[model samples]
Target: MAPPSTSKLEDDVSVAFRNPSHHSNCAAELDNKHVNDQDDYKPERDARVWLIFLALSVSAFLTPLELTSVSTALPTILNDLHGTDFVWIATAYTLASTAVLPMTGGLAEIFGRRPAMLASLSLFGLGSALCGAAQNVPWLIAARAVQGMGGGSMASLTNIIIADLIPLKDRGLISGVLALLWAVAAALGPVVGGALTARPGQWRWLFYLNVPIVGVAFVLVLILLNVRAPTGTFSEKMRRMDWIGNFLVVASSSACVIAITWGGVTYPWQSPRVLVPLILGLLGLVLFLFYEARFAREPIVPFSLVTNRTSFSGYLQTFICPFLTLGVIYYMPTYFQACKLASPVRSGIDLLGFCITLGPAGVLGGVSVSRLNGYRVQAWVGWTLLIIAMGLLSTINEDSSLAKTVAYPALVGVGGGIVYAVASFPVLAPLPVKESAHALAFFSFCRAFAGVWGVAIGGTILQNELSRRLPPSFAESFPGGVALAYATIPKVASLSEPARDAVRAAFAQSIAVIWRVMIAVAVLGLAVSLMMKAVPMHAQTDENWGLEKSRDGELEGREGTEEGSDEKRIEKESIEAVI
Candidate 1:
């Protein structure tokens, strides 16, 4: 049975933003009644809180830094370590990260967010240290997976902490800033990786560089940020966690990712390598959901959050939006290199337009949401722009100028910035403060999961189009003239003159075809964005609305009355739980 109705969930979460302190403070007090003994929390302008947020942002930036950096550095790393298992280098981290995300909330609940964050940071630092020192591809892959766990945790925890600290009214602005920082990090990652790989052994420095930064962030968090622990005996907290559910989800989702990633890339879609995992992963997913809904004491993704229109809608939107964005991100450089005949450096430079526009676009989108105190309009605007961007990109041929190509992809970036600007608001807004961590975990999971799907599906579409567009010519011209050649930028030198022209034409046409498919994906995302209902952001607090707004004396009196019973109940519960 569902624990809370959709309307009830909304009421439990939604606040009168105008007087957030009263609504949220009292609501939190009522719910916990025991956990938060430190009655004074940080105000909006607290230097300490903002400092903590900044520190968290650095961790957030670090996650994407590793993600984008590895792509450019992998070849160099491969050169030094030299293993056929090179493919697993990237996939390992992705699998570990995605598998670990569902556990983050429960970890936070048990360990407390501060301890969880510190643990994650420490683990990532250790992983980075190991990665820098690795002598073999397999060992490096293992380190990357360890790093990914920390990266995944940091990504989820940052969002959860942001929601914990910021009120509904101001979250958009902060979200925008974070998005901007991510954009900067993502854009810089390739450059940093490429620079490090300029020398044969320099690639190891990429991981090495992170250790010091992580150390600083760890010290800062340990010193400045403190979160209230949930009220429970350690055993009760352990019992409350859905350990079985976590295992099932990790197993199921990791299996599915392995299937999707290897399918049509490393293995044939029909190969047992692909099919068995696909089948098992699907079964596991169903089992995980069933356990969460029916048997788990505390579900990772609670039914209330899943069923609530706004929360579910946000989840859908997050999954699909990134699915589209990742496709573009994955393939755009290929388009520049193959069709436009640009050097890798030139290609990376061309991508700067996207990097630059998205940062401001994200911030602007956030500002719009914050000032308007409405997110639906922003959603419509963002998705519509993406749909239009993808559609425009489909028109590009080999003859299309760099200016046109640059401008076209920039639209997708702009749309990404806009859509992602308000990403967390809808998910967290309609859920209680308690569920914020779960919502953020789910949201972050969508982004991570989309990475696998985007690259695999986009590669499949491009390869299929190449096979369709140049059937006889495709087989004859290239050295290895099957779909796999097109999988990663197919070299055109194997073909002489007219055949080479045919190859280029095929490649360009194939990219256009992918762009058209992306348009459909964008359309799907836009369609879902329309389903998001507008929740009110502003509320009048003078009427003793939501959280109690008692006068100073009255507030003290109420606290005094509740203190004795609350303390007694807490003591009794703790003792009973321990016993």
Candidate 2:
């Protein structure tokens, strides 16, 4: 792949621009040029690549595991810490990670990818260790913040590294494998957490587990990963660091996530706690946008990349679909325990269907894309399955059978696998190789941000629904607060039959509401997927289409040239319309 051209960048700024198809040869020519400079670019394939994948996969595992694992242990953590703010354990990590995501791409670029990745793993492991040793709720929250910072880099950088090693045509298959790993980690988290909480002195073991894995990953990366730096001196690379841009991104995202997580949970949406941060986050975002557009040498997120309708719409679909899917994953366990009266262990086991199906579906989707080269069909299939899953889930009730629960989650998991397989392809396919890391990072960032909103919105929905459905007789059952008392309630076997029945009825209604909202979100995502223009699957590879060489000897493709001058006219008009 060739480096990006300032000339093309200028042309992209012109009032008239063509679609990507018109310049299909650009990517291919650039790839040939890069291959000619094979001596300068030593592309090695050793067993180390798989080792790197495994190490990064382990780091990635810790992220979703941390998120899901804590749910099963929240009761124990709250009791042991003597704290009512159990939500902080999850929220703090999420908020910190979301805040730091935008910087990972830039950091990887400025520093070598290997160094940046190893640093992320080390920080995450240290934070996990700290979390295990925390004596109080504050310490735990602080430790989680450190973990979040490390997690931010891991989530984004993993994809960036994958993009670096794998060709676009093969990325779908690799991405499928990564998606499977993610699903497994997410699904297994609760079970592992439950087991640890159930065993003596094992709750701390959850965090401790990360230490050895990270240690091994760090050592392997240091020894095996060979990353090429940009053609510049150390000072030149340092100059490109974009510290101000990174700071602005972190501040804005952190504030926004905090507001989202805290709103309607710890504080009223309209209260100062929410309003102040909301306003500040928005202001910081506006400033960041202004800076990126006007002043930064190498902006963290480029507007031109995001402004393209295909990329923009694809990103939105990426964000909203996962937001709804993960929202369900986060809350479904509660429904199983509260409504079905299942044990925590049983609830965790029930979630395995979703996790187990994801691996095969993702692998299938990846293999299918590799053979067929057309992602549009897969996108449609995914959306259809997602809609069906959401629709089925909406029918859940007080006496819903366990079979329906398993079926709905599995369907959604399959859709998730397909979506993950195809979603990033469209977003990354159009860009030059140099921009791939940034694009991948942005894609991951959007998903992480979505996860935060998913948890927040799902929690709010459940809380509100439960509040509305609470029995009048139980209104005085807890003088302190219903939310607090609800937190303490164990699996159904712990409650009397009548009390269990009441809780089940309330939980059933709440889950139904949540599922309805999920359906709406899924429908919106499906609509967005429809709007996406279906590019040919052959367009996935830089080697397939010929273009030219840029400075870095990577493929340089000419895009936005397919439509006639009239189409370019339309592009300008569309930009104006949005403005």
Candidate 3:
């Protein structure tokens, strides 16, 4: 009923890392394999490979840039667009991104990586153009969904391509470099968004700016990215896709996000608007998993990916870390604006402490994993630090000093940076190289999906707290219960003394709840991460997806291998028998 255990040989190798005395042959084999890996495929030594990595780095930069920039500019966007619903603006991007992530591995397999990547770039560019031109709220939300689809696919593809090019053991420094780019983009995003929003109609430039950058990255990918395409007719390729699985995932994810976004904010939690979709979405997901496990000819998320304790822990940690990090990123600006009375530009500048620390720490973390050849310790250290940071953050009040404001988030940066850099190791370590695409797609999906909950839950807590904390008369003046936080920010500056102080304290206290929840989540992450064993990283890249060298330079013949034929035959026999 299931495919052969792909990780069996790797799991045997991993035992050597944990107990070398009893498995000396495994150790010797692993060491010799690494020696061969160094000589055979070192992308660092190839100029063209460097260019391709550069292209991926640039593409990777765009996703975080859009995410962070939108956060700083959101309050301003709501005012300019005359929109009451702030949740949809943020939720739409993440929802679309999460829904599209599960199928990207299959897309890369069916269509070559280069073509899939180029298509994603095109969608991103087009969405950016539409976002810049949008004059209303709904139109902008729709356009952001489009941009999200592209961004999500690109994010998965970059890692997928990197896995194709470099062995896992050698990917540390490379991962660090990409992490640095991410930190830079994240740090720059808020500042850029704030500067653009400082002037009337200037916010359009935020979206417009992405177009030219996308154009450059697209051209580079088209010219230089020459990875191997799968061999098959269109019909054959179509048959291999898990179409039903993809549709179920997309539809179910959308329904769930819509429910989460609307619950307690746009509608009462008890209302059918919230309950029906939530229930249906949960049921749909269960059905989807069942279909994938029992009936699909080629499953996108094989049960093997999650059934193992080590990989399951990896997925859980991946989901939780981003859940905490995004809550901080999205809500910290609100704290600056509402409690500290900082302007959009000032708030963005205030975040430099966090932005500056995250990048270098990530590089250090990745390098440590490479040098030490173990990811479990680094992850433990990271989660421990994050727990401490979140605890300190919860102690902030209205009268807290700027030093606390700046220093606390910087602590988060350090811990988050470390965890984020090496989070993929445990998931990939015990798995075969061929499973990288599926595993990484699910990895990216978990990360993106967590963001949806992070923002939604943080907003819900803040709104409910504000309702209780704000003066009764003042609360009544702003009609919509949960929707009033963003609207109340601009008005905070004009309030009378006692009321003003009350509102500030309310905001400070409400935001602290978000941090308190992060503390609990971080602790859980730390505990879950302990399930990860010191599995050895892979020393080989997927042979099927490796780069295709130019004929004039270096000709490498493809081995005649009937890959996945046995799995296909098994699936055919099982289907004929019926589930």
Candidate 4:
């Protein structure tokens, strides 16, 4: 394509800024009601905008709450279900969430954010209701999967909405506030679950609780949010969606989740049960990539975004942080319950050290990025704290004091808050205005996928260690030996003091292994962060500034050439097709 003359490019930008709504269609964005970089693009602080933000905040808090809420209540849920589907119960929702994420962008683009968000909330509420009514483990697992699909959409859209309304300069502060909701929810999920599971049938309340809360959010969104949608019939909208791509994404993700979950626990690493799904998943993912890049009319996740150096860095960091964070969130309770012999409620209380500090740090980090005008240095400090926190965690054992244990994980929570607050900006800030929503969808996909892997990794370690050690350790006085010991917590009356001590020792060692793995992961994350393009506080970067610059550079050589006219015509056609 021939590059536009400098004066002409300038003219377009000036006019576009002058009236984004009027000029948006000529270049690329049909639905960018407000361009992010223009002064007029700033989000309104009107009652309506804030009300919409309120609805978003409620769902933001609830997503993490639902995700982590099941951890502390697992033992009780397992016992009551009378089945060994504990891993499935835990992984199903996360897996569903992960699978749905790749399609969220396309779905939102076709349906509009308001409808997509409302549909996700409705699915989540329905899934929650079903889970509360479940009579068996399988039923509950299915419901959780359903719930997770909704959560994936909710998580993805909340940030998309922010990008939709708020300009880049002040987004960090608002993003920080949103991160606070996540921090609080993540912190409180297990506590709420533990408290709910205090009685015989109390676990059901965790799911039942979502009904009213989602209903409230649903009403808020219904009344407040009015997003722009394309003009199309129902069939046109459906046809425009990347349905084949969506199916492939779901299939590959499901297979990957299965392989990850069963790598060593359900089957040995070499067994077909593990290897087949693992290999199939890898191949399917490859096929999905090729299909999206070469064949799909509209890809659910744009391959171009992932290929960008800056965007890839953000997604990679997002994935690794959650993988490590959930590794701690899921397994720390095991340490408290088995080693310290704390009740579920008490163990959740012990976690307050980590939880209490996390939200403040996220809020601080988020606002600081805006005030300081950059993300690089804060990220460095955040990663350093995370690595330090992991190192401290490596020292914990069965005999560790409650205060020390609390302090170690508390450090991790703080670091997590700091790093994650500004993580998405790199991907978002450097993109074309219209592409930000797709980037946000990919970001959510990475985070949700990481949660599943985190749990799987932690569980694999704990289960492998317990399987290796429990039989010998418990042989002295415990008749049921390893199986019984691993199934029940140390506080159970059937286990004698010696047996309980042995079980606790084994779990503590396994948890130490988890911490070690996380240290390696955190170090890897640090290395990745170092290589990313640094956005300094003083850069004065625009949301879509680089895209225009890059496009012009690509077309520079074609300018004034004989082939220029044809190329320009093709480029314009491509832009219109996508829009």
Q: For candidate 3, write residues 433-505 as lDDT tens digits.
A: 7789999999999999898878887887887788888889888997674477898898999999999999999
lDDT of 1 at 210: 91
lDDT of 2 by residue, 296-369 (tens): 88888887667666677778878987776676666777777677766556777888888778777887887777
Models sorted by TM-score, best on top: 3, 4, 2, 1
Sorted by lDDT (best first), the order is: 3, 4, 2, 1
lDDT of each: 0.72, 0.73, 0.85, 0.77
Relative to the unseen true structure, what is the C-alpha lDDT of residue 199 in candidate 3, on a scale of 0 to 100? Answer: 78
> TM-scores of all models?
0.81, 0.83, 0.89, 0.85
Where model 3 places Cα greater than 4 Å from the true spot, the runs are 1-45, 552-579
| Candidate 3 TM-score to native | 0.89
Q: Mind giving the per-residue lDDT tens digits that candidate 1 earns over 341-452?
A: 5544455666666667777889999988889888888888889999899998899887788788889888888998998887666776666555667777878887777766
- Assess candidate 1 and give its TM-score to the true structure: 0.81
- Which of the two, 1 or 4, has more lDDT? 4
lDDT against true structure, model 4: 0.77
Q: Which candidate model has the greater lDDT, 2 or 4? A: 4
Residue 48, candidate 1: alpha-carbon lDDT: 68
